[model samples]
Target: MNTESVDAFQARVAKHAALADPARLRIVDLLTLGDFSPTELQAELGMPSNLLSHHLRTLEGAGLATRHRSEADRRRSYIRLAAGALEGLAPGVEHGATRVLFVCTRNSARSQLAAALWQQVSEIPSTSAGTRPADRIAQGAIDVARRHGLGLADLPPRRLDQVAGVGDFVVTVCDNAHEELTILGGVHWSVPDPLRNNTEEAFEAAFTDISRRVNDLAPRVHAA
Candidate 1:
């Protein structure tokens, strides 16, 4: 085999080795949908802090997971699956929700695109909101949507509390919104803010990321 193929095989072997333990596998399953802090993982797993830390370190060393400081609370950190870490892995468990509510800091780009993409793929009913909303839907988002043959509605951005309802599956699409929210039972995707660059490439990248996530999640979530 070529060097590239050999390297790829070794990386896959390492990832599989890292997940050999039941505790580590469970941690990966929890992170398949959302980010979680050590405290939260500890609580969920009922595992001691020391043991949890060891597993997190092993996953990180294997390049299967990452830990980032919270954008809201600098002292706290969240653990998330590394990008493409679960490629070729089985899908996680199913979820039931009345609707899917996508959220971001400004509700200008990421959340809007996510909601639109989700609607195209699933019948679970989806909408979007912001923690601190922008004055209008971003032009960059509109352009990207048009390129993808999707329409971003002309509706004004809404605040989270105004639109979110019980049974809604909340997905925070940006790091800022995810860190700011203390909400329980929500998913967090650490997608970068594309609007910061305000370029076609940036918006397209954001759209692509959300599109993959929507496709991955749509089948797993069913209307309650």
Candidate 2:
């Protein structure tokens, strides 16, 4: 190959190489829609901090991703896809139908709302589960969805393991879940749970917060 061809070939080879590992591929899948910090990635992927850090560094080195320290909290850094990485990875593919998984300590509230709103707004495939599954979906969650014209009648509280196989991205909707459960191989979002108050107003606020996060996530979910 000529010099230019050789470099082009090498770039493509590296991009594909970066995705060779299951964990790394999962990271790419998650970042295709948004950014995450190292700590967040560790919890979401359920890997050791050092291992997750190494993988993230590798991805960033390959120009597939970028990381920046949080302005509000310098100790934290967020990782996101490099500007053109998605287009290069899956040229011409439509991303509107991506699948996502929402998680919380209990599947009754925050995660449930996230999944329902995501499905309603993006028209994408989504599911909700808990690290410690709840016996039933929260009525507050149901009420919030109904207020937004989304239905939760058919949705059931599920365990993380049950939906693991179908997740393109896995987001933890509360700090407790984000800190406690070790997420394995999926995108992570750290959202606070609304069930703490157990009040109708609190549920409404939680629903609103989740809806906003879901909207921000829609582009990344649908980006090809």
Candidate 3:
């Protein structure tokens, strides 16, 4: 094999090797659902922090996963599957729209993240509104979005009525809002609201969850 081919072969081998440990494999599986901080992973897996850290480090070195420091809290870190990472190892599901709308209770956090994330990947434009709009966007949410490189500054929060209407692809990002509105033919994702505690960790967790959902849903929205 040529030098380039040999390097590619070795990289694949390294990726495979990184998953050899059952703990690492479980970490990857959890991340597939949504990004989680090291603390969250420990709580979910009931594993030691040191052990989880070791596996996470190995996964990062193998180009299988990556971690991002929270803009809200420097001490906290979120681990997510790297783009194009483990592409061939995992089965791909083949899975779009226009003027997509994201909704939540306050239009403060979850919905905003979803709309911004969708904007990045989908050809369709997106907007966010809340069933009962808050006076302002949560500072923690703004920090998280900034970390993701989305400039959410000065974006005014809107009420659901302001943006809701037929022919709009409405997606509710809160369980309560989804259950209440029961938007006809609208998609719903039960995302946690970080504003409950108004903590940086809460916002970061919400951002990670919303980011994953938005990316996953982009294709379907664009195809519509």
Candidate 4:
């Protein structure tokens, strides 16, 4: 190969190298679908906050992901995959297959929205579950999805362990759940719980955050 080709090849190698860890891969998978806070990622992947933060920093440094603060709540920040990070990973490949799992304390709001939004935005296979499954999907989540032209009518809550089989990635959408669960197979993202408060304002804020994350993740999931 020419020097230019060799340089491109090595750069790609480094990108994949950064993602080589099973834990880091899981983190990419989670971010591919939505923006998550570091705290939420720690809970979902069941890793120490320090460890999760380290992995996130690595991903950011490698240009595999990006982080931004929520406009509604400055205290909270969300992370998503970097643009074009997944591109050229496979030449001439138009689509890649991926399976994503969204986790939260209750599979009612954030996780539910994530799963539905992934399905709507990309062709990748997706599912949502909770450490503690909710009785039903949160109404606010459903409403927000409807308004956004995404549908959530058929989705039902499920327990995390009930999702049998291998997933390319797993994401935690709640802080407590992210801290509580470990042994998830793939990338871990820490997204805050949207249903922690029942207020309309809180629900709208959660919806906006989820929507932005879903959009950011569509490219990676579809590329996979």
The candidate that achieves the highest TM-score relative to the unseen native structure: 1
Estimate, for each residue in 107-130, the C-alpha lDDT of model 4 and write its tens digit.
888887878877877777778888
Q: Which whole-number lDDT from 0 to 100 does residue 173 have in model 4?
A: 67
Highest lDDT model number:
1
Candidate 2 residue lDDT tens string, 111-215: 878877887766567888888888899887888788878887476678877776542566776655655654453445544455667788888888776776576
Worst 10 residues of 2 by lDDT: 88-97
- Compose the digit string of candidate 3's lDDT tens values, residues 124-177: 778899988988888888898888789773678898887876567877777567
Model 2 lDDT at residue 224: 19
Q: Candidate 2 regions off by >4 Å?
A: 1-98, 182-185
Candidate 1 regions exceeding 4 Å error are: 1-4
Ranking under TM-score, best-scoring first?
Answer: 1, 3, 4, 2
Residue-by-residue lDDT tens digits, candidate 1, 34-58: 7888998998899999999999999
> In terms of TM-score, how similar is model 1 to the real structure?
0.87
Badly placed stretches (over 4 Å) of model 3 are: 1-96
Q: After superposing candidate 4, which stretches have Cα over 4 Å from the reference? A: 1-97, 222-224
Q: What C-alpha root-mean-square deviation, in Å, does candidate 2 show against the real structure?
A: 9.9
What lDDT score is found at residue 168 in candidate 2?
59
| Candidate 4 Cα deviation (angstroms), residue 131 | 0.9
